[model samples]
Structure formats: structure tokens, C-alpha cells
Target: MTVAVTGIGVACGLGHGKTAFRKGLYEAPDIFSCLTREGRGPAEGEPPFIGVEMPEPSEVLAPRLARTASFSGRVALSVLQEAWQDGGLDDIDPERIGLVVGGSNLMSREQALAARDYSARLAYVPPRHAHMFLDTDICGLCASTFKIRGFAYSLGAASASGAVALIQAREAIRSGRVDVCIALGALQDLSAYDLHAMRSLGAMGSMRFSEQPGQACRPMDAARDGFIYGEACAALVLCRQDLAAAGKTYGRIAGVGLAVDGARGPEPNSAGQVRAAMTALVEAGLSASDIDYVNGHATGTPAGDDAECETYRTLGLEEARINATKSILGHGLSAAGAIETAAVFIQMKEGLLHPTRNLEKPLDSRFNWVRSEPAVHDIRRALKLSFGFGGMDAALVLEAPDSGGHTS
Candidate 1:
């Protein structure tokens, strides 16, 4: 029972499509400005900066859909189509294909709007507003849009959502429930309300890096204050190794591990996170030395950076080269895993590593974090780590196509 990744797609605040997102990854923008506050509110100057203003539905999708829903729909449909072609699914059974998605704010802006307007007296705003509350049900929305009649679930572990979704999708394929599993990760549009709430939690920031909107996301740098909250949608097509054997594979989803630390609100347990990474390595039947690079879930938080550094030292991966994707694409929350995974696929394909922005100072003494420029390294095996609220930690190992191994 092995699983291999055959197709990948990503859309984020960096741009509308995978190519755009990839370009944004390697280039550091001078600034990352905050978008409209459509969902919850963040304080005036908080750490979780918002990205991607409400894009017109027509730009990313057809008419008659909300912006958030449209982004999800567009990415899912595009990935499904691309994967079908990439995997050569002409002879495959549509029924044998399943969909699994992870989302933090399903239709957060919509839900917030509906909740705000749909009081006892103002219950008749419009059907659109009413639909927002329903949009929070990510599972139903994803299934309906994709016409997937097989196994489907919407997992919400806050920031860990994407990696967890991939883990679950791999399990489903390994269990023989389906021949193909698609894991989609997306987030809702942000609003001032969301910004204010984040500010209330002291999570927002006044990180006015520069006039350039792209340069603001600085990961692992000494001046890194907080994260720029961005919205994105990404999808991955996972199939059995036997299927991959019949054709070509972008990479292999080698192993997965998850753990819980019970840390404070919206923060991860560093110890638990380390254990998860170790478990993933062990499950893959490999050692820490097998991993060449790490896509860190460093959200520019004080506790998170220190915790991750401690975990790296504990796992004896202090010398492992690490970079933070959040600094590039903003914190896409649930979509971060899928987006980062796509980036991993790119690196595996191109044989080049994107450097972590910032990182003038080491958060910890042991780990070798990347700086402003890309690093040239031999990346045969890569680790993707994600931490969410309630101390939820997830780790996934990806092997380049020639690695001769797969994940399940």
C-alpha cells in the first residue's frame, strides 16, 4: 500500500495560478499590504497581516459564486482536470476517485456577514447572505462541486489543516477505499472584523516592510515580526505506487505522522511537533539524514520559532536546511500545506531550493535556516512540517521520483 503524488496545483495571494505562485515564492516582495477585513477583525497593528483583497469572482471564476467559493472551485476543478491528464486517467473510473479537503475559515467572510445581518429583525437580507453560513461546511461544498461520490471529509486543524488532509488522503488510498484521492486546501476571505479579532489576540502587527506589496513577508529573519495572512487554494492528486509505476510520478508521498501537544490557544506544542517529525521519518523507514530540506511552518511567532528550533535540535536535524514558505505566500492557514507541498514538488523537479526570506539572526543555535537567496542543495528527500492550534503537529516526507520509495 503505497501512495504517490501525480498532480499538483496552487493559487494564492501571490497570484492566480501555480506558475504565478511559484514565481512569487523565489522573489521577495518589498511589502505585503493588508486586505479588506471581511471576516473577523484584527487589531490595527497585529502579527497576522491579511493578503489578497477580495478579488472579483469573474477574475478567478465564473459569475454567480462568492469570491472564496470561486477560489476553491477554480482550484479544485483545475487540479482535477490537470491531474486527470497528468495521471493519464482516461481508463480510470471516476467513482474510484475521491476528494478530501482541509479548511480553516470555510466561508468565514460569508458566515460573518450572514451572522451579522441575520438577527431577529434583519433576517431577510438576501439568499446570498444566507448562503455564507452554509459555506462554512467545506466538505459539502467540495463534494458537490467536484461531483465526488466517494470518501470525502473537511478537516479543520487551523494551520495544520493541509498536511492533515494529505495524511488522511494517503490513508484512504492505502486502505483501498479509492484508487485516487485528491486533497484540496483553501481559506476564506478576510475582513476587518477578522483583523480586529486577531488584533484582540495580539496576533496582528504593524509590519510595514516597504511600499512594495511582495517584500513584506520575511520568514526566519531577525526583523520578522508576524505573518501576513493570505488566502490560497491548492490540490494534490495521490494515487497508488502501482499506478505511478505504470506512468510517471511527480514525487512520492513517502510517510506521514501527526501528534498533539495541548499547547495554549492557536499555538502548537513544539515537543509534540518534534515527535511527529520523527514518526514520519521512522514511518518512511528513513533517518533524519535522509531529509535534505525542510519547509518549516514558522508563522513568525516568538513561541513557534523557538519551539520549532528546539524540535529540530531534539531531532538532531539542527544542520538540516530550513525555509519558511509562509513568508512568501503569507499564512494561508489550511492551504499552507498543499501550497508548500506544491513548492516542494517544484524544487524536486527543478533541483533547486528557494531560500527562506529574512533569517539574519538564528532563532535557535542548531538549525541551518535559509536566507534571502535560494540555496543549491541535493534534495532527494524533503520534509514538510505544519503545526496548528491545540498543539496539533503534522509531518510529511516527500521523495523525489527517482527515490524508489512511496508514502502511505
Candidate 2:
């Protein structure tokens, strides 16, 4: 029951598709731009927050779907298109394909805009608003466009929604419910109110580097403040290893772990993170010494980064080379997990690990940190971590496609 990643597609500030994403990831990591009032940035009267916004994808939806679809839904469709074609899923039976969309309240910004625009003309609000407000709208749009009929649904686990969706999609295939599944990290599309709330809660970065947007997202750095918002949507196509086409597989999901603290809040729990990491290791039949690299869940926050560092130390994984993808891509909130997973696979294939941008000073110097520039390394096994608000933590162990082994 080995679940292999057959295809991946991404739309982020870096660019669209794997080629652009790969080039930007290594060569031009500092692409953060000022958040525009009209774009995916802060609205008027809100504190200035800098972040990365995705370039428009080449794929455009039909005029009919475009009129009613939310921005998040439209972006997701474009991303999914790449994965679908890459996976060669066009030949697969539509009834055997399933989809799992991560993140809830994905259309918050769209809904907020609609509310403000139609406040005085409530009666003239578009009828599509009825379905557009629901997070499942993304699942529906993707399913219809891609012809996935086995099953499709949306799941929310705070910021870990993407990783959790990946786990669920893996399970769907392992359980024989579907021959292939798509795990999509839907764009958060945070509204002005959402940004204000996150900043008020001290979970988001301040305006310290508002003028220097590139330095705003400093994950795992001593000078880091908080996570910067980014606009990104990524999709991964998972299927049974036997179903994967020759030379098309990216890697195999050797193991997965999910843990939740009993309490609810934004704070990180070292114990829960350790539990998740250890569980994933045990599931993968791997020990601390076997892990070569770690895709850390460092969100440029004080509490979050420290907790993750302690978790690695406690797990005796200090020797693993680790880097923060958020430093280069900014935090995609719900989309972080999938994008980072894709990054890990790309690095594994390319034999080079992308650098942690803005990491001038290491938060903790004990661990092996890939700082400032890309490093040449042949990664055989890599661990990816994702933690969300409300005590959600997830870990995944990915094995190189050429790695010979199978997990039950």
C-alpha cells in the first residue's frame, strides 16, 4: 500500500508550474513584493503587511465558471490542471478519482469584498454567493472541472489543513476507496479582518521590514518576528505505486503522522510535535539516524520556531540538514504544507537543497542549517513538518522514488 506522489503543481509568488517554481526557488528566493491594496495585500486602514502574491497562471477558466467562481477557486483550478496532466490522469477512469481540498473559509476575502460591495444593494447580490461562500465550493469546482466522481470534500485543521488533506488522500487510496486522489492546498485569501486578527494575536509579522518586503519573512532566524502572509495554491496527485507511470513518480510517501494537543489555541506544543514526528518515524520504520534532511515548520515566529527546534533536539535529529521554506516562499497558511512537500521532492530530484532566505543569524546553531545559498546534497529520505493553530501538528516522511522499499 505504498502511496506515491505521481504529480505536483504549484502557483505561488515564485511563479506557476514546476519549472518556474524550481528556478525561483533556487536562483531568486527574495521575490517578496509590497502587498497592494487592490491585490492580495492589506486593505485600506489596515496595518501594512508585506507578502508574496502568485503571478496569474496561463490557464483560464471558461467565462461561465469565471463569473461565479471565487478567486481561490479559480487559482485552484489552474493549479489542478497541471497536476492532472502531469499525472497522466486523463486516461484514468473518472469514477476512480477523488479530491480532497484543504483549508476552510478559503473565500473569506472574496466574501468580505462581496459584503462591502453589495451592502447598499443587498437585493442585487449575485445569486452565486449562495455556494461561493462555502469552503467546499473549491472541491465542487475542481471535481466538476476534473471529472473526479469517486468522492470530494474539504477538510480544515487550521494551518495544517494541507498536510492533513494529504494524509486523508493517502488513506483514501490505501483503503481502496479510490485508485488516485488529488490533495490540494487551497489559497487562504485572507481578508483585511483576518490579517488584523492574526496580527492582533501576535501570530503575524509586524511592520519592522515593511519597506524591505524581502526581509519580512525570516523563518528560523534570530531577527525573525512573525509569519508573513503569501498567496499560493498547490496540488499533488497521489496514487498506488503500481499505478504510477514509469519516470513520472516524484517520490513515495513512506509515512505520515498527525497529532493534536488537548488544548486549543495558537501556541505551539513541543510534546505534540515530538509525538507526531516520532509516530511518523515509527510508521516508516526509520530511526532518527536515517533521516537526512528536514523541511521544518518554521514560520518565523518566536514560539513556533523554538518549539520545532526543541522537538528535533528531543527526537535526536540535530544532525539532519534543515531549512525553512517559508523564508523563501512566505507562509502560505493552509497552502504551506503542500508547497513545501513539492519543494522537498524537487530538491530531492535536483540534488540541491534551496536556501533559507533572510536567515542571517540562526535561531539555534546546534542543528545543521542550510542558510543563504543552495546546498548540493543527494537526499534519500526527508521529513516535512507542518503545525497549525489549535494544536494541530503533522509530519510526513518522503522517500526518493528510486529508494527501494515498500510500506504497508
Instruction: Estimate the overall C-alpha local distance difference test score of candidate 2.
Output: 0.89
Task: Give the total clashing residue pairs for model 1.
Answer: 35
Which residues of candidate 2, in runs, are more than 4 Å off? 37-46
User: What overall lDDT goes with each candidate model?
Assistant: 0.71, 0.89
What are the per-residue Cα lDDT tens digits for candidate 2 across 33-83? 767645345646765767877876664677876878888888899999999
Strongest candidate by TM-score = 2
Candidate 1 lDDT tens digits, 1-408: 778888776666665555666677777553356564445445456444445542432232344553445344444555445545565655667688887778755655655666677765575766544443443445555555554667776778778888898999999998889988888776545566666666466554344653555655566555665666777777888998887645478788888899988776866477798789988999898898778788888887666776777777777776677888777667877788887898888777877778676666766645777777987776788889988876789999988888876433
Which clashing pairs does model 2 show? none
Candidates in order, TM-scores: namely 0.87, 0.97
